[model samples]
Target: MPTAISASVAPQTGAEPRSPGPVSHPAQGKTTEAGGGNPSGIYSAILSRNFPIIGVKEKTFEQLHKKCLEKKVLYLDPEFPPDETSLFYSQKFPIQFVWKRPPEICENPRFIIGGANRTDICQGDLGDCWFLAAIACLTLNERLLFRVIPHDQSFTENYAGIFHFQFWRYGDWVDVVIDDCLPTYNNQLVFTKSNHRNEFWSALLEKAYAKLHGSYEALKGGNTTEAMEDFTGGVTEFFEIKDAPRDMYKIMRKAIERGSLMGCSIDTIVPVQYETRMACGLVRGHAYSVTGLEEALFKGEKVKLVRLRNPWGQVEWNGSWSDGWKDWSFVDKDERARLQHQVTEDGEFWMSYEDFIFHFTKLEICNLTADALESDKLQTWTVSVNEGRWVRGCSAGGCRNFPDTFWTNPQYRLKLLEEDDDPDDSEVICSFLVALMQKNRRKDRKLGANLFTIGFAIYEVPKEMHGNKQHLQKDFFLYNASKARSKTYINMREVSQRFRLPPSEYVIVPSTYEPHQEGEFILRVFSEKRNLSEEAENTISVDRPVPQPGNTNWESEEQQQFRNIFKQIAGDEMEICADELKNVLNTLVKKDQDLKMQGFTLESCRSMIALMDTDGSGRLNLQEFHHLWKKIKAWQKIFKCYDTNHSGTINSYEMRNAVNDAGFHLNSQLYDIITMRYADKHMNIDFDSFICCFVRLEGMFRAFHAFDKDGDGVIKLNVLEWLQLTMYA
Candidate 1:
């Protein structure tokens, strides 16, 4: 059994700072100058819709297949180490960290530890990145990591330890693996020099390209447009930033705190102090986080701390918002320089939180969880078979019983039966019963009832040998609460041959079977007074063939041909016979002189009736007759096959021969009885019975088929009367 973890954390309410009111900034009119062409229109539309897209290039199926053959590994940066200890070591190594937008943080961390207890690969795709990251984070947890991977030899013998990364490619998620390390400075694997020595980085890039667009060439010179496609499922809509706000870090932090991934901008008319420098120009960029804002300040004075991350990670505001712009000339040069601390190019910046909310699009969150439980509060009953099998016709004492009700604790009852045995053959017929009871305080009185019932039966069988010698053996019967009124009988005869069975402890343990319906029935097993539902009667027939194979009586060629012809006439119908066709084909065959005349000839009648016999018995059952006559118009071959003997006219001899060929071997008395029973005033038996009788191999089958007058295939009322008057009478 596996456990599901909740994805989101509950909101914290104690001592959290209140949200700030909206404020207007002075630098609101500046246009973005970083990118040559302005995409403000597209950006505005995207902001209004609030749909995030992962811009990645599409690749042909053929190319993707080719790339799958190449093996690659993604080198992960040390900053995101396997565990807390590794994290400390990686950071101490002075590795440049590959940072992303702050709003992307989630409560459920991914990542687990690897050891004898746990070792397996996990995947992350679509909006489940948070869950995947959580899994990755969990790798640091002790034995908790091994829970996901089953500990078995199946995993050790094969390359089963691989985890896959799926991103929407073309139309569905394409699998990709972590291949190589990102760029690194010093011993770190992030923000290294462009000329850094690393074939692994190139390999990773190649693998990424292969996963995205199928070829390294396609990935070679593509700009951010192509990269976005490869990353996200759709294209990116760039936007221009006019006069952006200062304090972007605060804005980024605030967005993250609010669980939002949006950014903002401001067009200011006057110079505003941002960080330690004054900014007063058109600025354009994406917002990442929001920190804080000064509220209820003087009407003329206002400031906010906002943080932003550039997807590219290198660009910054160079105008009035730049670290050392002249708008802050009122401050000393050295002091201004101090305020202009270097903002890492890694897609992070500071701006007004308000502006950040207005400019960037927020990605949607999608997480799901499901839960299931087993109950102990159920009601049940035991079903006992005394003299015969569950089906009607079988040897005596081959009884099978089960609980008549559904049981919540069905497994417990089954266990008890599996353990019990008996010595005396007569007393071996008894076993144990168990019931699981649970308290339910529901309004309904019955709702608080017991849950399940299980029982076990002990029985014996006799074995006879040469010289009239006989021995008695003992066995057990088991029943469960899950399946009502069902008990499995184990014969002592079978047990003796399989294992030594003589004497053992015998205990009538109590059991319970849960009821499927609401009702009451007689209680047979447990002595406890409880309302037990009656078990539904299920008629199960078991077909037992003799152990010997290839013992069926052989049929002659003529018989085979007759059987084939009969089947062809029946086609797809069920219970086809003269009794079935009486209302339809009977009237038609009677009214149409041509049909009667044709039928008068044995060959023609056989041709028409042969198609009605489906089972190759040379006889047409009611079902087969009904189906054949219904579609007689569609049967073009019927007339040809039934018209045997090639004579122009059919006589009594031909009719008798056709019947004989079809496998009917009745004596004159039986034939006359059947004929008179199914014949009309014209002295001709109806086509339904005519065809039905041909395939009937035994006298009993013929009698049974004749007794069913309504042509439903089953004998109904008056069956005995009809048989007495038509045959023995």
Candidate 2:
């Protein structure tokens, strides 16, 4: 027979609220081209280490560069070499496409012409305007700009043909290094380049980014938030301009004041409208960074204004309040001078807030810290970010809709101790934002690995159960509905939601919307105050302590009673078959009201007999029954321990630990099979099912090892061998 296997809470206080959708969080698909193992032989399932980016150990640009200089050779990245594969994953390589160092394209090259500035970036031949938009905002803050683009190293000083950049990946900042080779056509940069001909920092930065994402073609189009997060390790808020809040201008002010990076765009309604030049001078579907914001007196009224820069480095806005617009006449001359209003056509321009909202379709605010949303300057957030995985059979329990398997998903505990800081709001709720970001989906685009439909749900733990430090099981979810969840599960790189949940103990369950879909993810929760959180687990490892019998332990004359029962159960032959065992077990089950069982099924007895029937007799002899009785007793205790409420079903996820506790190693594949075979509609197993599963698994492993003579985990079973194996198991 075949086997099968199976799965972020947010905080809130009672009432649920909804934010306007679509218009608020509209995302663009192509804005610009720019962006097992084994059963452990126990401890052998995985290499317990954080391997460097893309399986290549990070090479130090300094060490490699110094070595290159000393050896009188140019530095060339061995990992991401200047090759066609690195330049384009799907497109055919252009014949004249050549890779050249900065010096090859110019007589004298400089890392930065003067200093890293927004103007340093000019859209080249790639469709990664979204990435360029983010880069423009990155240049506005020296601290953040330098963090991504290091200040040291120039083209002529000890230049080793190498440069390094830092990007936030998962939960850590990864230092990505690359050689100075730039993809070019006829000695000219092919992608993002600087306005200055001899300057190459922007070009080099683009190359490094392309390397990070696998190829330049993978950077074709994406949301601005994606690049903003990669560059700053910040969380972003999406606001659909047409549906924006009345106080959106104020929110932008606070976000900028808190050192957040911002970008906005006019999205294309149709494919043909992409990059369409509007009469107002703003290009539809083009990425733009919000570089400045201010309020000025116009016609005796305070007019909100926003300044934005098109990454194209040209096409200044041509509307009221734009560069050299007639609207400037409405404001006092002294006020214009104080605000330092300028009329330069450098792709940067200002417009009234009303016009800004009407012109731009979407706004993105990437906050360096959660405090960017706080009105109180002293208030801050307690942020907890966890790296987790949804491994098939072991942890990839689908969504709650699949009640039988959802509990198998990864579980996390989040405790909010304080409420949101709001004097006017009456609800005693904790305001927090939870973002679940899938890892490596973008980098895997070349391999056709798309984003998994990922989302999280939050369930408030009952106060009575909070004292038990164990992973909530399927039974828990079967009884308690999720209080809050993401707007909806979507196949996006990240899904996030802000919630004002009641302060309490909650379990955050993150999963791919489907069973057995495997992937890695980052789950982050930001609370108004310190949050207590960790991965929730009820798994009892073989190395960890298990509940012991008080006073008398097993094997202490208790064996005598067990042996007597086995003898009585086995007839004159001093043995018992599956029928006999079922009769005995059913009799006992009916006699005990506390057991809460409908009696053991025939399948359970058969599995029990198979486990200990060493001789091919299809039954358990006295000695075999003795061994089976001991296991039954021990397993009975384990089931009772998990089914604390004693309605007689244990959490489905506990099966792996239970098998391990019984001294049988379980790899994820085998676990998957067991769950498919035994786990019920509730994603849990009863006492009978548990015993049957463990016994059958034990018997199968034994028979498997017998046939697997070479022990390479492979076996060639003839008809006779197959009969011998399947007949009992």
What lDDT score is found at residue 166 in candidate 2?
74
Residue lDDT tens for model 2, 1-729: 111111010001000011222321334211111110112222221122232443235545566777889999887787798888887776785476888988889989988866788877888878787788888877765555666676666888888887877787877777778888887887888888888899887888888888888888777766667887888777876677778899999998886677678888775544466677899898876678887788898888888888788887788788888878876877898988876678776677778889988887778787775422223563456789987877665688878778877887877888988887789989988888888999987788778776676788998999998855566666788888888887667565777778888889898898887777878899999776778877776332223237776744345665655556666878578878888888766765565565667778888898787778788788777677666766777777777777778888876677766776677654444566777778886567888888887777667767777777887877798898789678867
| Candidate number with greatest TM-score | 2
TM-score of each: 0.24, 0.72
For residues 1-729, write the lDDT of model 1, one tens digit per residue. Answer: 011111111111000011121221111100110111122332332223212122222533223323543433222322222222312211233334342211122222122112311012111111111122122222222222222221221211322112223343332334443323222223433321111222122223223333333322122111122222223222211222333246444443332332221223222222231111224322321112111222312223543433332222244544433344444445445543543334334333344434444543222110100100011222122322111111101001121232111111111111112322345554423232321111111111223322112223222221221122111111223321112222221110000000122222222222222112121111122211221221211121112224667634425663344334445545565333443333334334554333433333333334444445445555556455444543443221232244443322332212333344443443323433444444454333434444444323233454465676776767754776665434421
The CA lDDT at 593 in model 1 is 38
Query: What's the count of clashing pairs in each model shown?
Result: 153, 27
Candidate 2 displacement at residue 643 in angstroms: 19
Candidate 2: segments with Cα more than 4 A from true spot: 1-59, 93-95, 329-334, 337-343, 370-379, 425-427, 542-729
